[model samples]
Target: MDVNLQFWSTEGKSFFQRFLHWADILDPTVLLNSNKKIEKSRLLLQTNAQTLQEPLQDKKVKEAWKLSLSSVHPGTGEIIPLVFRPPAFLPLATPLLFASLLPHRGAKQAIIWQAFPYFVMTQHKLSGPMQTFFKRILPIPLLACLSVFNVMIVRGTEYENGIEVMDKNGKVIGVSQKAGLKAVQETALSRAALFGTAVIIPESLLYFLYRTNFLLRNPHALTPLRLVMTVSALGAMLPVSFSVFPQLGEIKRDDLEKEILSSTEETELFYNRGV
Candidate 1:
C-alpha cells in the first residue's frame, strides 16, 4: 500500500488516528533520511508477501514506512525537495520570522513589509483609514488564490499524469485526472489553512499579549515570545490543517469519468490526496 493512500484512506478510521500519523510524518528527523534509505525501505515492503494488508506486527515495517513516506513522493517516486518537504517546512520557515517581523533597512523594503500584514488597510492608510480596523485583517482570500495558482504552475503535470487510485485491499486500480484535481485542491486548501491559522492566530494573540502588564513592563521579552508563539502555532496547526481532508479521498463510480469507471465496477475508489 502506498503510504499516502493509506493516510488518505477514511475507511473505519477516525480523525485522531490520522492526526497522530500526520504528526509523525511532519517530524524533522525524517528530513535526514537518504535516498538509499528510502529505497531500502520500499524494497523491504515490496518483498513482503503480505504488503497488500500491511502494518504487520514487525516493528521494522512500521518504521520503514515512516522513513519512506517522509522522503519519497507518492505519485512521482522522486525525493521531495529539501526545503519544501513537510518535515522541513517549520524548520526552514522559522528563520524567516526574523526577516518578516523585524524592521527592514531600506524604504522600499519597509513599504512592502508594512503592506503584507494589513495589506487591505495599507493602501487606505494614506487616506487616513483607521489602523485598528485594518490591523485585524489579512488578505487570506488573495493568499488562498495565489496558493492554488502556485500548485498549478509548479506541478501541473501531476494532474495530467494522474494520481493513483486504489481499491479497498490496497490494490492499484487506475489513475485519473479528476481524482488528481481533488487531491491538489485539498492540499492547497490545507496549505492556506495552515498558514492562516499559524500567522493570524499568533499575531492576534501576541497583539493582545504586548498590551498585557508583564509584557508592557519587560519589552525585551516580546521578541522571544513572538518566536515561541510562531513555532507553537505552526507545530500545532500542521497536522490539523492537513487532516481537513482525507489523504485518501473517495470518488464514486458514478462521479468518475468514463475512462476509470468503464474499467472498474467498484462503487468506491480511493485516490491519494496530496499532502
Candidate 2:
C-alpha cells in the first residue's frame, strides 16, 4: 500500500547525498537515481535558487528538478501495481443475482409448502370452538420440536465439547454440533423444525388476534382480516430467520470443553449399563 524509492550515485558523496535528499521529496513510484553528473549539477542550481528571490533562476531550477524527477530506470522498472479490488467479485455477484431470480423463488415456495402442511394438518376437520382451541394449542408442540432442533448435541473426540468448526486456515472459528449427527438428517430436521416453529408461533397469535378483531382493518374495501393477519405474520418470520439471529450472535469459548466432559461421562454410563 505504501511505496518509496532508494537513490544511488557515484558523484562526490556530499553532492550525491543532496540529490538523494531532493529525490526523496518527489515521491517516485519506482527507484531511479544513477546519474551522478545530473545529480551534482541540479543540486547546485537548487541550492542557489533557495537563497535567491528572482523568478528566472527559480524557473531554471524548477526545470532541472522536473528533469531529475522524470528519469526512469530500464533495469529496475518493476512497477508494483495497486490491487484494490477483490478477485471473486464477478463469480460471487453473478450467482447471487441469479439466485435472487430463479432458485430463491423455488426454494421460498418449497419452504412455504412444507410449513403449510403442518399448519393445515393441525387445523384439519375442526370448526368453531374446536378449530379455535387447536389453533391456540398446536403451536406448543411445534415449539417443542423447534427446541430439539436448537438443542446442540456433541459426540466426537479431538472436537471441543463435541463441537468443531474450523476455517480454511485450520483455525477454530467456533464450535458446531453439525458433525455429531449424520449430515443429511441434521440438515433436514433442522430446516423442518425451524420452518414448522416459525409458521406456528406467529400464526397462532395472529389467528386469535384476527378472530377477536384486535388488528386494525383497512378502511375502504373491508379485507377478510384473517387473510391480512396471515400475510403480515408470514412477512414477520422472514426477518426472524434471516436478520434477527444473524445480527444477535453468541460466542462461547469454554462451552465446548464443558459439553465434552459431560458427554464423556454420560456415554461411559451408557456402555456400562448392561455390565
Task: Give lDDT per model, in order.
Answer: 0.70, 0.34
Q: What clash count goes with each model? A: 2, 2
The top-ranked prediction according to lDDT is 1
Superposing all C-alpha atoms, what RMSD in Å does each candidate have to the true structure? 3.5, 23.3
What tens-digit string does per-residue lDDT give for candidate 2 at 21-72? 3333233331233455445534654456352233124655544443343342
Report the poorest 10 consecutive residues by lDDT, candidate 1: 133-142
Model 2 whole-model lDDT (C-alpha atoms):
0.34
TM-score of 2: 0.27
Evaluate residue 57 in candidate 2 and report its C-alpha lDDT on the 0 to 100 scale: 43
lDDT of 1 by residue, 175-201 (tens): 788888777877887877776677676
Error of 2 at 56 (Å): 52
Q: Judged by lDDT against the true structure, how good is candidate 1? A: 0.70
